[model samples]
Target: GSTMSQSEAAMAKANPMYNSIYSQLPQYFGEQPWTAGPVYVGAFVMFLFILGCFIVKGPLKWALLGATIFSILLSWGKNFMGLTDLFIDYVPMYNKFRAVSSILVIAEFTIPLLAIFALKEILSKPDTLKLKENRGGAIATLVLTAGVALILAVAPGIFFSGFITTQEMAALKQGLPAEHLAPLVANLTEMRKAIIASDAWRSFFIIVIGCVLLFLYQQRKLKASFTLAGIALLCLIDMWSINKRYLNDEQFVPKSKQTEAFVKTQADEMILQDTTLNYRVLNFIGFPGNTFNENNTAYWHKSVGGYHAAKLRRYQEMIDHHIMPEMQETYQAVATAGGQMDSVDASKFRVLNMLNTKYFIFPAGEQGQAVPVVNPYAYGNAWFVDKVQYVNNANEEIDALNDILPTETAVVDVKFKEQLKGVTEGYKDSLSTIQLTSYEPNRLVYKTFTPKDGVVVFSEIYYPGWRATIDGQPVDIARADYILRAINVPAGEHTIEMWFDPQSIQVTESIAYAALALLLIGVMVLAWTQRNKIAKKS
Candidate 1:
């Protein structure tokens, strides 16, 4: 939950259009507040390769060196002491991404490539100049690795204090009691110190063993093949052992369990029985907490919430402005009543119902069971609105939702009002009705009847791809109620269809098919031309 909130906050702040509070927290900007063991082990390997640059010379060597330095600087994040701030401020799109440590993937690749080049140089047939120079470089690298390791082993605290700021520690305190905070902090500090000391000694030994093998190969005391095999074995063992500390066989589940991971629960089965298929489910059991973003509900039902790294900005804004606040209010009410609320307050869930959430799931008294409650006030798939209230901006449009009857009225942003050409204002047709006849991920069809021209609002997210047609004639789809689809419907019975057919997708697909056909034709021509040459050779 902390990670998700921090990531969301970072994303919101990075995008200037969003109305979110900018956080200055370290974790929000990809700074590690605690020790990461695997990173330390990986760093040791990278250091050895950095040293190898002294002997590994070529055009590829220079390219690798540049990549390695850039990757290292990015991976250092805010820890480089203000260097990363320059990139965040001046570099295009740098501030948009988090987890700066992941940039080390470049270093990971270059380090291994350099390591192989250095090993080849050391094992190759001795030429006096090259062999003498490489051996000295190898010795210097070994000394540096050993010296750093010895210092860490002797006084780990000298480099890292294992102390985190109060604000940093507060991020981890969610859902934890006050009494346990002090003990947890103390234990964390001790654990980090121990990891640093142990990994330091482990890295030292691996480097020393690698140096020994290279020294033997250089001296001609060991066969090249044998020396190479020994060094390879040493690297494999060193990396594997260190990695096993964090991940191992026990971490993997059985194939059968993996397959059954999203199998329908009792509550899910009950909810699926509705058969309406046009509504969404809100699973309160795992909501507003650590597992809130899990997609278990989405596996079988249209869910109001699901997890994704890059969610639609408009949808996220809707969640922030409407959904979360309402949910929090309901939770507080339940808490005040000593956690014995009989049912979710339907009045408090107006925003959720507007999003077409028709079912709510909560943990039952029995351990493995859950209760699914139907929302009585949920609006159907599509509805005819009596009035179109225009708001000047996004903030006003969202705020207007609080007082508007979502089923009876639609709130349209003034910026988008220009897109509504034939849409009529103050148009109320009480006799008009609309029902969703068919639904697919990319297409939706609705049957409607209107005594007079009226606007129809669909509880579907408005995105660029969707195109709406009324009886085969295309019409503009408007962004209604901040994040839903709305279209103007003429009087009389008509078929309204919406299809997600993006021009960009169609163009890219056509290009891909054409490229494939050209490649095939080229291959055939080459084979035919080569046939005569083969016949002559024969």
Candidate 2:
């Protein structure tokens, strides 16, 4: 029942949007308003025009020099490092605004440089510097930088960090219903990510912005024409560097789409609708990011991968073939008692076995109470259904899991469990393998209620020494106790994972050795090359 229509679910996806004067008056003007991309492009072009004036030997070259100094300061202080991730906590919609603003900055540099390059090719002179004074260009740059800084400072929180949170509360009060507000808040955060991509579009915006400002100066009254042209060249270089990255491929969907698709598919395959199937088949081939198929392997774990894998594998072996020792034993007893096990029953078994083709419905009971195993995927806690039998339930010959036929003198084959040897390389003889009672996708969970005797070993056979912590406190844990580590945990839940140690012989040693070797080789090559070059010149 916890389901949504496709269109309704799509609303939850991230879509970041920002507005400017153009957007506000767009209805009347019809598409003249500049978007975030254009603004960034414009800014970059303006920056380069300032740069070009300084490089060329011309009047107001001092002003061009001043612009260069300002560009460096603004680039680092106001642009590059100015966008901090911490603002999201203070400003309610700061994340969304930040993303779009960042993109605009890139566009500022890209578009201007492109125009400058085109003009140079048309003139057929690659190296020429001619510039005159652009009266108000300096003031404009200063004003833009100052405005951006002010916005950063007085944004939601000027006095105290706590005030930012307070402003958020006040803003939300007069808006949508409290229930609806949470979803919107979540959506805004996602939108921020879309606008923050470090890609070509951003570069394009920066160049364009720089060009427009220079072009303004080039107008006779404004003067500095040649300087603006040179600045455009610099913007072009930056833009080309940015766009060249995506020259090969085009059809790239956001990674977020793939992750969502995988989760939805898993959810759909988990509902139970039938109760007579024994075997389930899981095809893990198509699921993205290393999803395990349910048919080949099965195990008990809270993860969907484990549950589906186990259920389908068990169901297929038992129900489809009807050759499992347990089923064959049960059938022999019923047949001896004069009930014939016919081809019809075998056909029903086949249908039931194949129910894992998609997924079956399973019933959940109260916490701690054991439910009948309806789904082979979800066992122990729920009643599962064999989807195949659900459709053919009216057939009187259906020997469902619910039907308890009498058993004959059939015996179960005993499989002896073997003790595994430790895989630790150096001290294999000293360490013992720990028995895992349960496993999650990324971890194996084991319980040692009491500490094991004999040097308390944790045998691990991985390269790069792992970190060992006692109750989350870092300790001087060594590789010796890697596999069967003896540690004291509280009687409740305990977590452990193989942690990487950089100082050990695993990673750091190799890097250090490689560095030393490279240094020595470089010195030898330099001495030989210098001696040969001098001899040849003589």
Candidate 3:
């Protein structure tokens, strides 16, 4: 959840203990301690400029210093001496965001500002004394930056020593084939070392070039524009080269390719042929990123697994407790059977069926084609439960799901007992039917016929703004099956419509329309008044 209260306590508890500056500083500062390259190479180039600003005394310098210091402190994250913790505890809204390291954006901004200010000051008044000071500062900055680069370039092993832990190495070996493990590990270590050493030399060369250009300008041998341009060019080339290494032209694909990226596979094509798109699809291929809710599957179908940063708490809880565990169990079973469980498992179809997953997509047997397995047990959009088990708390509600048939039984928390006072449970009538007649992202309509008054749980995530009406009369939607919506239906035929009607959204829309109307009226009045004034002047 994006809200602070959801994950703040857990994040605070997970803060790493900072032992000493030398030991922990590298973790927070740059990409890697051995490499001169940082996560943001542009920021690193500006950092050298910031160091040079120290010799040029001004109010701007002090301001930049203060901002940079604050940024650095925040960027230290859990590595610093409890400063981040103090902020999260006492500062309002500070704990709302998780990545404290992102605060270094301020430092990145301040460094360039200070650097530009220093350059302007030096160029504006090129007195011998000021030039000498500038020369001294430039030399000092170059020496410090270059000396570290030199050491890294000469002997990277002295500082880094292939910092992979024994446990990490073992894990790497375990993942690889026995015959290839040793050679791969050795090659990977050498590659990492080479990258660091190479980047160090690259940084050293750029810094030295910048220093020489500044020195030439100080000596009055080069024009101000030329010197500045030369230094800027060096910084641009250095940062661009480093950046290209990560995000190159190859990363981008044509629009057609991007559209084709989500092309319907053989399994997807099979699912699409169903015509009844009431149910969701569960892709066993898993999410592209670490997150369960990524939009990869959602690009084509209403996926049970879709990405959202501030996903509904109950939905996340459902995934954590029910979906993920079942998937993991399937994976473990395959692994135990001496089969490489790389892609999908058909055995975990039970959980998918409960989520109303109509089609399950999995990797075809070594063919690279997707195979869609139709779930026979999938409950339709809505169903009448045979019984409702009232639970005291969330834990019990989740636990009750393990034994109950999801299509014929629902677990409702005791907190909702009052809402269900008029609603009857255990009223099973096989003749009753609920079919999804119309659907939209924000609205759903169901044509339902009930043999008797009963509760019908809908396979939709229970969220705040969803409102339900049976035959245009408002009905209470209860949280059923831990994360789905359930509403009581009368014995007769009724139009059950659920729509997202958030008051906040309505209010925001009204305000926007009103503001636009006012602006248009004001513009018309002003134009009329100006016309009369122009006539009088004429």
Candidate 4:
């Protein structure tokens, strides 16, 4: 549930902290990273990486170096945000990805490749690493690694005293008194410094030991096999020691604590009773922090708001413009009116109803059980809106959602005008109706009876790869209500179905079959070869 909220996402252009790869206070300084990042390649491997740079031969070395350098620079992400922004703007498909530091996977691959090849060079030609420049390179590598560690270990404050960001300071100040906040900040900063210093010493000691072994092997004081074994042992110890810090016995909990973890609250019970096709649940549970970050609501119901990395960009846009503004207004009203379910203006939930949010679970009462508040004006699974309000741009389209009632109108982007095909005008009889007859994650079946040509809006999230059919013939589904699907339907009783059948699936299937056939052929050939070899030996 770490998906960035619409507010934070909107602010991302001005603030780099909201970017996927930007490090945070509790994460970078914490003992264990929240994203399971800061991938450790081991101290010994890193030492070999530096030594390998000088010893590795040919263009392969340069390729590996290039890969290493590319990954490192890209991994800086928001730290050197200009490069990241340049890639996002100019590089094709670069804008589609997040978690920029994940590019370090390339460095991980290249580092090992160079390290192994460099070791091979030394084993094959004993005097290779003994050359003046190569020896100096090796010495310099040790000096650089150890020297930096020594400085950081001795005086970390000199480099990172002012590490706290405005965001971090603001977050820390919450619920903290003026006198106490300073000491807390100081202590945390000291601890962060200590953590870095500790790790620096750890890296320094490991590298020194590795260097000592290399010196011994080069000078004929140790056997080649012993040197290899010692290096492998050192890498194991370093990795194991670091890994144990994150994956330890403390993570285990008692059976009682684990059992019934997703037990239903009273709200869940009330919500589960509603046997409708589908409806989204809202459990902001009285706080903005709970808005999109809590997944507990999703445990038993389809949530209107929940965190996920791959949430639809269109939905995010809707959140930024429609949902967030409406939510803030209602929450503010609720706060002013004394924070009760009755204080909530059900009328203000235009965006919410359009999303078909039926139940809002609030934590209340003596036992603190979830209290379910039914939104009576929920738009249901499907509806026939009176008109399609077209807008010039994204901003206009989103803002238009609030301008008119979502129950009567759908604000659509002008980009989708081609799909509408000059059929923007709509008319739905008050008696005319539509209901979701069947609902599946990928397929939806709806029954609609319209008196005339009208746009039937389904309370389903708008995404690519969905194909709409009226009775049997395929029809274009237009982007409607900012984050919903709507199709122009002819009058009379008809079955409307929408199914997800992405074209990419066909290509993927072909690739899978080809790979399978190749694997089978390889297996058969290998079996035949083994049989022939066994016969000859016999």
Candidate 5:
């Protein structure tokens, strides 16, 4: 919630052991380590990017230059941690984003646009010596771009050593017991050197080719038509050939393979048979990444896991503190019990049960059937808690969740204290019951009969959009158990409804429609004026 203080935001962003540098280590990008550090913008663009600085002029040139420089700095990925930290700490929504190197796309885009302008300037004024700016631009582009290319071709390792993924891989493997890794690492090191040298040579050749064409055009030895065609063809060849190394024909799979990707496996078919409304499935088979970071499980059932880099901060906190640790504990228990998960007590995994994880998908058996392990203690849609445990801050609130029994108690932040004023002192009675009468995407109805006013915690994730009502009278919804919903109900049988009414959306939609109508009217008026002018001229 936005109610989290500045200190809490900082706490949330803090990672003492992990940073941009640490992320280059193996498995950081999970099976795709090459994605960790990539700076390739293509050889053609590299030459043009450097040349554009000298040739391109005016406010647009300065804008392009500024964008290119800042993006490159940001692509350093917190090698400038002080500056990056400031953005994360103070700048709105900056801290929420990631993949620092993604900023290079700005440089990539602006470079090509500036390069086209640079090319136009050269083509329009072939005689470099005619204008002082043209002559200066030509000399600068050649000396700087060609000279750097020459150096890169000769000493490729000097500039790029820090960004090498192979070095990180070697360091990571050295700590393990793999005897074969020594030779593999050695081979990879050689391959890395070859790739670096090849890229450098290729870029140097491309730059020389471009410089020669421009020089020839200036000397009148080649026509403008020939020069433009040569440059265009070179750019196409350079970009295409280089990209082919990464994305080639061999990478394409058969139609059957593509079809098989989404084809519901026997496991999925089996799980779909359970017509229960609200329960999550945990699919461990084909789990290459962490459970929550895999999306395939979601296709067949309400998976207890999913993949999203920008998931809600509070939910991620729950995953770290509650879900992951509980999952590990459950795995350890099953292993200890000789892989018989049924022998393990479901009560021990209080958090998982509260999440309503009813089924666990295991690997295929001898008969090629997906094994489904059922969790018996899964707490359904909503449950009446015995008490409410309130904490002063988010950190304290999340910390309190570690000790409490989720089914019996709810850990709530103190910010929601006003709404929970009446039921701060909780009640628990066998006669008091709450049942989910109906469920819809936006609305949930519950029939409740309580001897006295008490708090009922819903398994559904709490969001600001959700509004609670006790017989149509609006009541506040408290964020409980770090991410779930909780509301207080008065004594006696009552009809309770919770609706996801994101009220601001309605206002935004109306404004959008009004703006569209205004735009249409303006367009019509402009078209009418243009038509009148044309008619008068005729």
Candidate 6:
């Protein structure tokens, strides 16, 4: 059965048009603090909280404290190793902010204190912990109800992680970019918005729980021993199961289309590198392989992407199989000769994008397996070839080789021009345009065009840097990150090209990213410092 080639799949993985958050998971893992340690620490922390909860009195307060601690442990574990799919099943809302380990830690500290404050009101009421004679039955019912509810909440998470859905399986079969699953991939970007909703829900739950306990205190119906141990126990079990899962799988695990895209991408890169004159075969060539003097090894690497390499490899494999033993020597010689010529040819194409040649030649082998290589020239090397040899004789693979292409084919010269036209010729009601002044790497300036009434509508300035503004106004520039940005004008018209500021944009981005990193580092450092400062003050 034929499967889509890795090259085809590469188009998908190389550009993750959507499902970008899935890409961030790896980056988040790299940034997590706990990645340096064994993940089992979370499990250990869970055990400590469980033990502390059961051994302590004031069960609601203790249970709240335990939940807070357990959540923190789970958050860190998920953040570091990317162990989080199960959280999506049970507490889907939590999964969105799981990477925000520091925020979750703050929540853990705040939630328990809030629960304790709520507990204080209830316990201070008369006979809050005291149980009535018939209340044993009520307590038992509450315990069982809570335990069952807990199991219901937890079981789905444990089961869902073990299997992939039919959709994911289908994506793998389709190959790359998961074109069939594009819609699903697109949804991943909106996960942060979904996460915000989850946080609001958690806030609602906390408020409801606090209000109920406060109401009981106000009515004098609060009991000290009125504990929901069943609910607390269920929470403990669920938390423990989640911790166990995290401990078992600490890898940055990808799911569905994410996994398929990642795996296929790796496979494609491997094949391209192996088949082409990449890092493996052409260690001598600089990147883009456009040197004045060509390296044979680099030529071999560049040639692999062309038609010749494909046919050469096919013919060589055929010869190896003895399908055509007598033809092996001639085919091998031709492959070697073509490879040598291609190296020289590739340099000329590297100089310019337009002049880049795109054809290759492969002489026919003794067997019928040989095919011609096409697209021999790349950028800069377009017109560099002066002479070429072809196999014309049987004895000398060189002697047999022939150069059918004319000398002009050796080098290519390409010219591109843009003509300007009269502004009134294209559009009516147009008036005289003002002169353009000043240019930055990504920003350009021009005078606005006014109609006969002197009302300006458009401008006549060019943005070679990518963006142009008129009358100190900004224009929305797309593809500003690309190497070139050009604005066209019609023939017989006046136009000016000015470069905009790219360095400023790049510097701004670099500084902002650095500032963010420093800010995070500062926050963690400050938190630890404050803890020490408080300890000293105490």
Q: How does each model score on TM-score?
A: 0.77, 0.22, 0.72, 0.87, 0.81, 0.23
Best by lDDT: 4
Tens-digit lDDT track for model 6 on 82-157? 4455565676466445244533655445454543453443355433334363235334433443333344333422
Residue 246 lDDT (model 2):
31
Candidate 3 segments exceeding 4 Å error: 1-44, 56-103, 127-140, 161-171, 177-179, 285-300, 305-317, 328-350, 362-369, 386-405, 408-432, 449-454, 474-482, 488-492, 501-538
Candidate 1: residue 179 lDDT (0-100): 79
lDDT of 6 at 44: 19
**Ranked candidates (lDDT, high to low):** 4, 5, 1, 3, 6, 2
For model 2, how big is the CA root-mean-square deviation? Answer: 22.8
What's each prediction's clash count?
0, 72, 3, 0, 1, 59
> Which candidate do you rate higher for lDDT, 4 or 5?
4
Off by over 4 Å in 1: 1-45, 72-103, 123-140, 163-168, 171-181, 242-248, 251-255, 331-347, 364-369, 386-405, 408-415, 422-426
Could you give candidate 4's per-residue lDDT for residues 1-538 as a string of tens digits?
1222212222232234223322323425422224743578887787777888887768988999998998889887777888888888999988777578678889989988888787777766667778987989887777777777778778876665464556667876885677767765655555456566767888889888987887788888888899889988998999997777567676687888765566877778888998887888887574577678767778789998888877778887777777877777765665465555565676787888888888877666666567777766688888877778888887787767766887788778888876766566777777798888888999999888977888777888877899988889999988877778878888888999999999989899999999999999999999999999999999
lDDT of 5 by residue, 60-105 (tens): 9899888888878776755888767776788887765656767778
Using TM-score, give the best candidate's number: 4
Q: Please say which candidate is ahead in TM-score: 1 or 4.
A: 4
* Candidate 2 vs. true structure, TM-score: 0.22
Judge candidate 4 at residue 477 and give its lDDT: 88
TM-score of 6: 0.23
Task: Give Cα distance to truth, residue 84, candidate 3, Å.
Answer: 5.6
**Per-residue lDDT for 510 in model 6?**
97
The alpha-carbon RMSD values of the candidates against the true structure, listed in the order shown, are 8.3, 22.8, 9.5, 6.5, 8.7, 21.2
